[model samples]
Target: MVILLNCAHHLSQRLQTTFVNYGEATMYSLETCPSPWLRSHSVWGRYTVSFLLIITQLGFCSVYFMFMADNLQQIVEEVHVTSNTCQPRKFLVLTPILDIRIYMLTILPFLIMLVFIRNLKVLSVFSTMANITTLGSMILIFEYIIQDIPDPSNLPLMANWKTFLLFFGTAIFTFEGVGMVLPLKNQMKNPQHFPLVLYVGMSLVIFLYSCLGILGYMKFGSDTQASITLNLPNCWLYQSVKLMYSVGIFFTYALQFHVPAEIIIPFAVSQVSQPSSSPAWTWSSP
Candidate 1:
């Protein structure tokens, strides 16, 4: 009888232990299954993608600056010499289309593509970069206006075709990256505000460029280069201004190259300037 009792007691304890073990294992499996895969992929995949993007952006900007700087410098010197004495060269370039103005056309196609991007935050960062370039150009232009135009010039106006052309270029500068706006806008946390941001941002850009263009043109006149960098005055001032403008151009290219890189490889989207947590919006469900 005692033997039978002992056997029965042992069976009960064994059953209890098995139930507890199975319960704990089930909970552990559930908690770990979904998260481990996600964490691992994010840590490894995200960094890899971002690093590749940075490399490509730097390469593109470096190439552009290397090839274009000399012609631009010559144009600036000529404009400055002519503005004070000679009749400004007959609208130097034959067609307005020849310069960065062509980039304005890129805005439409960029918007169409932006609609399909899945990440909003990445778009915001890109938009911010474009905004900075435009804003920087405007600031350069404004400095020219403040310095060059004199006599009843406390208020600046769009006085001539040259003025109009300069302003048009300013618009081009800001809107040049229009292609990236839509995608970046779509990725924003509150996309409705995107247009507002665009208007406010671009208006500020216009003001800056208009001022700079007027100043640079008045100071250098018709001899100004396609870029504002050439119009810089000689002396210590020119060196500092040159460095500042050069930095702006470099930054513009960084964002510009990033746009294509982000499009080609979604992973690269994270490489654009931003905090570590920024989401990369590469794809969208059609």
Candidate 2:
């Protein structure tokens, strides 16, 4: 991650073309970079990058759906405690829902409406609130876990290769914000400092995630639920954490949807009405 992050920054600096999207960055990095050896398959680079990003962004949105659903459903459903900690379920549930899938269904309409928002001001407001609530939720989660943690001495060193692959994949998804690197750099007044900002910000993110993962594992051991919020106490404060988390992820759905929208929507619109000129994307090249 560190190597690729710096590589992209330097590569962007060498390319004279301004990139507004990941596809543009990919195309230039392949076709027009200063080093000829680094450039190849320029024609297809934009398409490949767009396809991969579409899949990635869609997967992220789907995860957001499931994340909100899982956390909110735990808060809504009636508690059904199991004696087996290994199969722990239901900490604090308020209402009854037959299936977890139903919780995702309830979130669908709002998510659909969320992506249609083109106004920058509204998105800023929503993102700010989401950031605030997300921070609060993480604080609450940390507080909840630190109360009476168990011994980690008995914990296994590592899981099998399969679970390790799952960990690797999840970590990759966590860092998928790298897709916005070129656009972020492009918007900078002093783009040279952008790399510094990226490095510092991502370093902090890595540190925080490391702390959270270690603490969560130490706190729950083998019985950890899919979400740490679900393991929280069945109280008003903890329940609020669940709601805040859902709201945060809920608003985040729009940001994730934005990337694919820019790539796909224009082409779809162009197909509806034929213009003499080519579609707006323009091969993501200069």
Candidate 3:
């Protein structure tokens, strides 16, 4: 756990330094242009960042989708099958499709629509709500962890080499916000304070990730799910936690999508026709 925490901290600081150096070099372009530093880069640099952003955000979306689907499925199974025997065997309209698939299909349109909303002001409410939900979920998770502390004797100090890749991948996925650091710094009212903001924000994030990862592993041992939320007990409170965190993840998708969208959409538009006087052209003009 200590090693993981240290790794997270160092990785975050390294990302911050990279972003700061990049931003310092391209501050003027980032402030004036829609695509920011990406547009100013060589073809290879632009494509590399674009590919990483697209892949990372897509991975994040998949994680969120699975997180929502798995928890909701568990909650439904608990309520309908184990507790409320009187309820219908299946609650979904698409009986042929799996419940998780049904949920994903149902929510996908709204997520797609959200991607088109370019205005950050319009997304601020959802972002605020997401922050709240995330906080609530963390509190509930900590409560559960403390309530049932596990014996340390049985737990491994380090996972075997076979599982090391899983640990490494999970850590990378958790800290993949590096792609957004430049964009976020560009948006700040006082850009000079971005270092402080990054430091404080990432410190909190590292602390939370460490606590949840360690406590969750301690409690569940080897039986943990891909998401700690899915391992939560089948109760109303924890069910609410799942749903709330899902909402947070749902809202967060748009913000993550924004980075890649800005990078790719401009290039796509440039290929269609000569840049026009329209807002879309102006926003994404090469």
Overall lDDT per candidate, in order of appearance? 0.46, 0.71, 0.66
lDDT of 3 by residue, 181-246 (tens): 666654556755766776788899988888888888888788776777666665567777878888
lDDT of 1 by residue, 1-286 (tens): 2232233234335555311111122233344456876444544443443454445444554444552353344334444433432222343333332354233243325434643443445544554665575456556545544563544444434455756876664454444554345444434467447656877867876676566656665665545676665454433343344545444553455345544445455445546665659754543311
> Using lDDT as the measure, what is the rank order of every candidate, best first?
2, 3, 1
TM-score of each: 0.41, 0.79, 0.75
The digit string of per-residue lDDT tens for model 2 on 1-286 reads 4455455666655765444455665666677667666576674777888999889888887888888888767666634542323332344435555588888788889889998885444665787889899999999888777767888999987866778877887877886665556555655667668768887988888887888888988988877765676676666666788889889888867777777776788778666755659555332211
Best candidate, lDDT-wise? 2
Superior by TM-score: candidate 1 or candidate 3: 3
What TM-score quantifies how close candidate 3 is to the native fold? 0.75
Estimate the overall C-alpha local distance difference test score of candidate 1. 0.46
Give the C-alpha lDDT of model 3: 0.66
Give the distance in Å from residue 197's predicted Cα in candidate 1 to where it truly belongs.
0.6
Off by over 4 Å in 3: 1-42, 81-99, 274-280, 284-286
Higher-lDDT candidate of 1 and 2 = 2
